[model samples]
Target chain A: MLKINSVGLTISAVPLLNNITIDCPRGSVTALMGPNGAGKTSLLKVISGEHKASQGEVEINRQSREDWKPAEIAQFMAVLPQSSTLEFSFTSEEVVALGRTPHATGTVRDAEIITAALAKVDASYLAQRSFVQLSGGEKQRVQLARVLAQIWDHCECEGDASTDGILLLDEPSAAFDLAHQLMLIEIVQQISARGVTVVMVMHDLNLAAKCADQMVFMNCGHCTAVGTVSELLTPELIKKVFSVDAEVITHPVQGTPMVVV
Target chain B: MKVLNTRLITPRLCGLLLLIALPMVSLLGLMTGPVFISLADILSITLSGNGGNSQEKLIIEIIRLPRVILSLLVGSLLATCGALLQGLFRNPLADPALIGVSAGASVGASLVIVFGSMLTANGLLLGLSAISVGAFAGAIITSVIIFRLATSPQGTSVATMLLAGIAISALAGAATNTLSYLADNDMLRRISLWQMGNLQGASWDRVGLCAVTAGFLGLLIPREARALNAILLGESEARHLGVNVEWLKRRLIIYSALGVAISVAVAGVIAFVGLMVPHVIRLLVGPDHRALLPLSALAGAILLVAADALARVVIPPAELPVGVVTALLGAPFFLWLLVVQRRRT
Candidate 1:
């Protein structure tokens, strides 16, 4: 399980995230749904060890984030930002090979892991293509594959350690098509099924409702609501969390919550 | 696509190959001087510590060896520094000399050569020392100022950093021109020579000092190779990878500046070696600094030695400045690069 304890963050005197705490347990997928400037990305960054909070701590499986070495932290946690700016013309495979940087000792093994990662992301066809030329959605998938590879290489999932890894993604499906978004949700679901804790900052409330077991609604740097999708993703919460009115309904097929924007 | 597995060959093996290749090239450089020593004499001198010919031995060991060794050290330093700067700035065109270290060193060396008659007999040493110290100081000052100016309260952007570098470079150029205008005729000549760059004053002590500084930094930068690789994506992205971007930037700047300062101090300003070697290495191997940094050092050593050798042989006894040789070599290649890049675009 991953725990965020009394987390607070500030950028240039403006508070982006303040005294916010959230948790994602193993075998569960948590979706952070928030309006623009709501500090969802900031929270993800803090969880991934990217930003040092003004005062707070992130504990992964009962160990403080500060206590882990960089490599150790990387092994347990992985993050995927919305967009990536890859300047060089490395092949998709080569870019993914970087995921194994903290793990693999030999180039051959790195190559093998990279190949496996590409396959995992269903991006095997992009293996030979230059990453600089990939489309926005393709790049996100590649990044996801890279982070997944990193997590797979680092996680010590053996023995009674039911907790496997922690994943934090920011708007991963923003550029993705509907099919791709659903695919990504399925991937996150599968990861959770493997006992890896997942936290995703998603904008599409309907998609978030379908996939997330737990939903966190953030507004103005604070988490306003945290509960099961059916319980918390109410029309009132939508209007409050995102300054926009929406109709909340139940999905006829899955009996899950759905938001009509 | 099959990946090239380079792991079987240990780093030690790679080091040994470079070690052997470097000395061989250095020997070749020594042999190709104006007064060439025959293989027999070279062999005899190595076997007996004296070839029974005083002139040949002096030419081989005293004059040629020091120069060859100095070129190797300076080239490696510049290349290593270039790789570091490129990684630090995340710009391939960024070189160690980009921040005015060379210009500052040139001014110092020129001052010594032109004004040393009034100061002391060993004016060259005084001048070189002054220039190196000045260059080191100038480089550090410019980098710090640029870093501070370019970075906003939020974060450091690469584009802003590049613009700042260009602005500072222009400022340094203006200062250099002002010094030249103020210099007397003899001073002007000294300045010109220093600006063109040379290895004629190469000595064991110069090589030793530069080797220590450059080697230490060279080894140090590669340890941060992973961090650099993480940064290639973006600062925000790198941070997400658990990197302390600000700390990495500061450390890289200092290390690269020290490396460039030592090189410029030893050898006037050998331009283009840093830019060319790292670019070429990036082309051959991927942008992975683990491979790029070390390979750039080896390739840079080879290139400078080869260029210095050409400088010696091209005009015979009247040797051309090594800077001119590298420029002649690198400019054409850069042009070709532009053409290829345009075609790709």
Candidate 2:
């Protein structure tokens, strides 16, 4: 479980994230949704230990975020940021192999895990291709493979064993095609079902509604609402936060709440 | 889709081939002076301690050997710094000379020479004549300052680093010029020769010192190969991958700066070898630092030894400042690269 309590982050007197308290239970998917510059990414950075809070703190599995060394925090939490800027021509296999950096493990097993991750994302074909040559959607999938490979052992889920880890993704589906987007959702669900937490910052409300177990909506660095999809998917709330007319309707196909704007 | 894993094989092969080629190239450098010394003569003289013609043996062992060895060490150190800096900055144009480290080190060495001369005229100075300490301090201070100036909340901006590097390079140049201005004609000539960068300052003791420094830094920098690879993914991503970004940056900055400083102290600001050698190597082997760093070292050594050999034979009697030959060789290649890059864009 990941918990944030009164975390406020300031960069030279400008509050990027303010007094944000939230909770992510184990084996669940929590999607952060908000308008642009709403601090969703900042909040995610704080939780991922990339940004330090000027006030308050984050606790993972009841462990203080500050107390945990970088390697320890990285052992469980994997973050995939928006819009990769990979400048080198490293092969997709090499990029995915970087996931095992934190684990003091042998390459033979790590290579197997990388292959599995690429296969899971349907990126097995791109494994030998250079990362710079991959298309946008392909790069996203490869990065997803990297994040997946970070916690591959947890996802292996031995008999009666509850696997543990957390995945933090920022706009993972931003440039993905329809098939890859669905593949991403399916893979994420598979990961959560294995008992790892998935905290994703997503822009697609309908997709988030269908996929996430809980929702946290932010506006101007403040958490305006935090609850299940049904509780947070009100038209008035979306209108007030997003400044757009939105209609909330139940999906007849999946029997879940959907937001149309 | 089924490509063989060449990244693993390429480095090993490049290293092995270079290891084989290095001694031959060094032997060529040993052979290429005004007085002809064949490989056979070199081997005989080296093994028996007295076989070759007496004058040729003196030239080989007493004069040329230390100079050639010093060239190899300085070249390797400079090129390694260049590769490390490029990796650290993530910019192909990032060279220690352009980024003020060499100029900064030159300033420190110059200050010592000028002020130490004053103190020694009255016999006030002792045990501090060597340029290494001064050069190392200067390089460290300049890198720290430039790094601080360029990094902020927006993260380390490449544009800012480049601009700051230019500004710091200018400042260090001015400081070095001021030191030269205060010196007499004799000291000024010494300063100019040092500034021109040469292997004439070579001695067995200096060669030993440089070899140890190179080996030490060479071992440690390549160990960060994996971390450096992750860093290319971006700072935040690298941090997420458990690479201590701040720590890595600090460590590389200090190590590369020292690497450049030591070389500059010995070779006296040889330019373009650091800048151009890595570019050439990257074109051949690509930019994986695991390969790039070690390969750049060997390439740097080979390039300088060859250039130094050319310097010896260029005029037949007087030696050319090796730095000049490198500039003449590198400038056109650099321009061609820029042209190609622009055309591609």
Candidate 3:
């Protein structure tokens, strides 16, 4: 379980995140939804230990984030940035193998995990290609595979009920095509089903409705609403949050809320 | 499996080729000098200490051997430092010289050259001459300033450091030129020659200093190869991957400064070996530092030894400075690499 206790962030005397609190339980997918400059990424950074919260603290698996060593936390917590600045000509497999740095699971086991992770994102064919040569969508998939490989073995123990890992992503679907986005949603579902806690910043409302178990809506650094898709996808709430007039209706096939603007 | 094997084979093969080429090039350096020594004679002298004639033995032991060893050590240090800096900055064009360390060292050496007569004693700290100590101090100070300028609570900015480095290099260059202007005729000649970077003054003492620096780098750097590789993915990304990015940056800057300082102090400023060797090695083997670091070191050793030998033989009676030779060879090759990379992009 990951808990954010009234977290706040102020950078250079300017407030970026207000007293935001949320709970992300095991086997759950939580989507952070907000407009531009809404503190979604800031909140994600605080949870990942990239930025420290000025007012409150974050707890992962019942331990304060400060108490855990970086190497220890990295074994179970994997983060994917929105984009990468990796300019070197490392092959895709080599880039993915970097995710295995925190574990002592020898080269053979790491290779197996890398291959499995790549296949999960449908990027196995690009394993031998250079990362710099890949298209933006392909690179995003490879990066996803890398983060997956970081926590690949965490979800193997089946009997335990506690959370095995936490995956943090910032705009993971921003560079993906329609098909890859769907594939990513499936991968997130599969990983969460294996008892991994996932927190992601997403833009597409209908897509978030399709995959997310809970949604947290934010505006101007404040989290305004937290509920399930059926409860929070009202047209009035959409107008107040996104400032656009949208009609929320039930999906014909999935019976979930669909927002049409 | 096929792809993996192919990726794995290239580095191994390149490593083996470099290993083979190192000894051959060292032998070539040993054989070609003012007095040409034949291969058999050189081999016999090296293997059996007392085998050759006394003059040949003296020439080999006193003059050529130390020079060869110094070139190897200095070359390896330069290239390895280049690889480390490039990895740290995440810029392919980043070189040790690009960061003002070399220019700073030049200013330090120039200071000693112009003002040495005033110091009553030529103080030796850790077996290094006063000039070397000055150069090392200058390099360290410059790097510290550049690092401080680029780093804040937000983290180090690679672009800021690059710009700061250029500014510092210009400042150091101006200092060096002013010293040159004030230098007398004899002092002026010494400063100019040192600036050109020659191995003609190679001694057992200089060789020992370089050997120690190279050994220190060899032991410390390879351990950080994985961290260096992680850094190429960006600082925050590496931090997420469990690397302490701040610590890694500090350690890399210190190592590069030390390596470049010592090289400049001992052999003046030899350019392009640092920039060219690592790049070529990266091209041959992929950018995996586990392969790039050691291969770059070997290739650097080979390039310098060969270049030093050519510097000796290129001019019949008078020898050209090894720095001139390296710059002449490296500048065009670097331009070619730029063109090729541009075309590809």
Candidate 4:
């Protein structure tokens, strides 16, 4: 489990995140939902330790974040940034293989994990292609596979109660097509089922409702609401947070809440 | 399961090819100098280790051999430093000169050439020429200043370091120009010749210095090959992958600065070998540092040896600067590469 204790972020005398606190349980999917510039990505960065919070601290499994070494933290946590600046001529497989850097797993096992991770994101065919030449959606999928490979083994060791993996994604599916989006939802659900905690910043309310078990609504650097889909998917909450009039209805087959604007 | 077939020439094969090419090119370098020692004579002298003071034996052992070895070591050092700097900056165009090593070394050498006589009476210090010591110190000081300028509580910022490097290079260039403006005719010629980068001054002492620096870099750099590969994925991503980004950056900057400073001290400012050799190797093997680093070193040695040989024979009894030859050869090839890449895209 991850705990964000009144974490606040200020850069250059400007407030980016204001006294935000949220508890992410083990084996649960938490979606950070908000409009543009709501500090969703900023909060995710604080949890990932990219940015030092101006106030308070983050704790993972009762251990202060400062106590963990970089290599030890990397063994269980993976982050996917919104965009990558990797312009070198690395093959897709090589890029994904970078995720195995922290592990001492031999080459043979690492290669197998890379292939499986690529397949999980439906990017197996792009394994040998040049990463720089890939389409935007293809690039996103490759990066997703990279993060997945980082924690691939941790997800499968279900009986090991001490090792819990965390995946933080920043708009991971923004460039994805509909099919890819659904595939990503399925992948998130599958990983969460295997005891990997997933936190993602999402703009699509219905999609977040479909995949995330817990939703945290953010507005203007503040967390407005936190609950299950049914509890927080009301029209008033949607209008208040997103500044848009929307109707919430139950999905016909899945019975989950869907937002209609 | 499919054998990771991506590159045109696999790194292993490219390495093997370069390994074979190195000695052959070195032999050619030995054979191509002004006196034109025959292969048979060169081999006998090399094999026997003494030829009873024959003129051919003396030339082969004393003059050409040391020059050839010096070129190989300097070339390998420059190219390896280039590859490391490029990886550290995560920019393809990054070269050792970006950190002001060449410009600062030039300024240092020029200072010694102009004022050394007044200070030392004889331009020697600790067995090294005062100029070499000055060049090495200048390079180290400039790099350290730039590193400090870019470091703060937030860690070393690559962008800030880049900007600082440019500013320092400009300042060094101005200093060297001022020295040249103040120099007498004899000292002016010496400064110009040093900047052009010649192998005519090759000696056993300089060769030994280059070899030790090359060996040191060879041992230290490859240990960070995997870390460099991870770094090509942005700094934060590299940190997320368990790389100690700050430690890696600091080590890379120090190693490359030392390698380049020693090279400039020994061989003057050899230009294109550092900037071009690594790029050529990267095109052939991709940017995986594990392969790119070693192959760049080999390719650099081969290119510089061949260029030094051509510098010897291009004009009878007179020699061109080896740096001039590298630029003359490298610039066109680099342009052609750009054209070819454009077409492919």
lDDT of each: 0.76, 0.83, 0.88, 0.89
Candidate 2, residues B1-345, lDDT tens digits: the string is: 565332324667778888888888889889988887988999888888878899989998877899899999999998899888888777777888756787788888788777765443443111223565566678778877888898786556656777898999899999989999998888787777777788876778778878888989977988998888888888888889888887788788778877887787677889888888887676555577778888989988988888898889889888899999888767787678657544542
Residue B116 Cα positional deviation in candidate 2, in Å, after optimal superposition: 5.9
Better structure of 1 and 3 per TM-score: 3
Among these predictions, the greatest lDDT belongs to 4
On residues A1-261, what C-alpha lDDT tens digit does candidate 3 reach at each position?
899999999999999999999999887999999899999999999998889889989999999988887878888899999998999989999999999987888999999999998998999988998898889999999999999998887654543523388899899999999999999899888888888889999999998999899999999999999999888899999999999999998999989899999
Docking class of 3: medium
Q: How close is candidate 2 to the true structure, as a TM-score?
A: 0.90
Q: Where does candidate 4 chain B have its weakest 10-residue lDDT segment?
A: B119-128
Query: How many residue pairs clash in each candidate at the backbone level?
Result: 0, 0, 0, 0
List each candidate's DockQ score. 0.35, 0.52, 0.58, 0.62
Best by TM-score: 4
- Which candidate, 1 or 4, would have the higher TM-score against the true structure? 4
Sequence-dependent TM-score of model 4: 0.97
lDDT of 4 at A254: 83
In angstroms, the error of model 2 at B192 is 4.3
CA error at residue A210 for candidate 1, angstroms: 2.4
- Residues B60-124 of candidate 1 have per-residue lDDT tens digits of 77777778878888888888888878877677888866655665565555555545555534344
List candidate 3 segments past 4 Å from native.
A155-163, B1-9, B120-127, B153-155, B331-345
Candidate 1, residue B168: lDDT: 76
* Of 3 and 4, the candidate ranking higher by lDDT: 4
